[model samples]
Target: MEKIFTLFLFLPIFALAQKESIWDLEELYKTPKYEETDLVNKKGVKSIFYESIDYKGKPTKVYAYYNIPTTERPENGYPAIVLVHGGGGTAFEDWVKIWNKRGYVAISMDLEGHLPSKNHQDRKNFEGSGPSRHGVFHDNNEALQDQWYYQAVAQVILAHSFLRGLPEVDTNNIGITGVSWGGMLTSSIAGIDDRFKFAIPIYGCGFLNGTDGLMGQHFKNGNQAYRDNLLTNFEAEAFLPKATMPILFINGSNDAHFPIPAMMSSAKAPKSKTYLYVEDGLGHGHPPAWDVEESYRFANAIIHNLPLMDIQKTTWDHSKMDFSAVVKGVRPRKVTAYYTFDKGKWQKRRWNSTPGNIKGTKVNAPIPEEATAAYLIIRDVKGMSLTTEVIFDTSDKQTMK
Candidate 1:
């Protein structure tokens, strides 16, 4: 009788707890009742709620924050850029904003166990830190078998897959960037995944752990027992061949995690295909002064099809733009300006443009108010183009909600 009474007493409490459970992401993501203001586009930032995706038949929810260039209507389909963060860090929303400032779509994917969804309600943020690397490499331990190496690899691939699936996102201009542990995954993704058009990995090195004893536990992108060899197994020199797109490898001269010479050998690409930035006294931080700015500029160039050294103009009010034509054969020293909406009436706006400009890479500029759309008119400048494109964005998106 006492046992029966105790059971009855505990049952309702258990039932009540289940009813009020806060850990259910399904309820959170499915509910469109959330305050849309929380996801509103700010001047340089914004957040979004993405529905769950099927990863290898398992239902998983993903939440990402992003920033996109100012647009009246989400473009037909914008390009994409994917950001992967280092270990122990949750989804990096900042990278999304970084590309947004450059007029690209940025998508940041958070794997499980890091950042809790506002609804996650439980604290497991850093629980999988060790297994994240070990499970993929020495993942034979049965107790932690599900924490397999491929799990992380799958997480990244799925992130790419998610980007590829968005209708408003151009599937052709996919790019990937990662830091530290993320850099390791970036290499693995570039090696196996062919969909990427460009790659930038900061502070990532290959084959060091496979041969070196100190960093061995972390060199996993696969299980050694799963028939395929380990990714950290090959030196950075060997892995260079797998990267087909242009790559900018940024690293601090003082980075403790990856040795410079070994990393350089492994990261080798054709002379035309790579840019290596070495900053003295800077450690493994991604935003280090010397390289971070350069990397962002590089990303801008790679994404926009705009040359890095030119003046860029953004239009206000989404007006149809028309700027003055060149002075015929004067080698484009000064560019004139004119604008009108709806063909109202063409009026010349007083603007000064500098000239000589290093093969017309730069023209002297004079400011013109009411400039409808901005234009760069370069004369007789031979320049190799870097195809810059925005590769990811969730804000103002027309893709699946």
Candidate 2:
């Protein structure tokens, strides 16, 4: 009886310890074992394979492309970035060059365990590749160490550590950005890896079950057990509350995969300051996703201590049929209210914008009758944009005034 009692007493402690050690930050923060490779020959760009956490009881390697600017570096070292590619994308040399030209050291890695090839889709996996992504929740029943999401996050964290160890890289100024699925990973990492100076997650946010995308469908139709596993172990929502770094959540109002509601939830999850940039009709793809100027501006603002655009609060006056937002930081050159009267899935809803009246720091616009939801977009004089949290009218009667 005493032995059993003692075991029960320690069970909760054991469980807590196990939960806290999920990513093993101490181990992941260490410089990973790596080997340089010459498979790709883009000028000034170097490719390498870094060791990551074990998978299915075997070792794994993550391929990456890194480059430094030819321009003079700061005394503290050049600010660096780790780029995580989305699903169906690989380590892109062009992506690295874009950052290198901007005078920032950059590294982009293939999370799918593929080698650099002319054809990204047909690239072959090198030996010791970790598990490829099967689906969002396909491997929920497997042990955490054997799951694809777990492996990918570990590899990204490893990449951050690798970049931090570089002699010419500014460890304190390193940031991360991921597009699409990679964006989802960035959202999760933002909460887990507080080492990043800032994070940009494009077209990716948590609350997958709330979206109309494949992840949402899977979460809704999946078995209760698997769903529970995903929510507990893999969902970005589960980890975002712990984020302590500034995060910029970028997405489109009509994004097919990650809808506005989910992105709002992710933006609100972080305790640290967060900004949003939900474009009116932004398309989903690597180029389109990364092409947003707000991303670069936000990263620059955070890394260089420049002012960032902040939307303080948004309110809806039903009686007046008006929506208003309080803006701060970086004077707004334009403010617009985007609203939708249609009330089905977010992706299919048509969005229309109306010019807002800006007085002092407040911007106001008239809300359309029967409007189901609305949000404000504030563009600064520099052409950078930021958004307010989305507001929804959930009443049975939609018509106001």
- Give the per-residue lDDT of model 1 (tens digit) for 149-168: 34454556556666666565
* Local accuracy of candidate 2 as per-residue lDDT tens digits, 1-401: 11000000000100011247388899999999888887765666998989998888999898899888988999999999989888888888889988888778999988888886767677888889988788765887688789899999999999999989999998999999999999989998887888999999999777676456655677677488877777777778788878899999999888888877677767777789988898999999889976888888888889899987778768877667878888788888888899887866777889988998888888889986567788888888778888887777655221110
**All candidates' lDDT scores?**
0.44, 0.81
Runs with alpha carbons beyond 4 Å of true place in candidate 2 = 1-19, 118-120, 396-401
Q: Which one wins on TM-score? A: 2
Q: What's every prediction's RMSD, in angstroms?
A: 23.1, 8.8
- Distance from true location, Cα of 128 in model 1, Å: 14
Q: For residue 278, what is the lDDT in candidate 2? A: 89
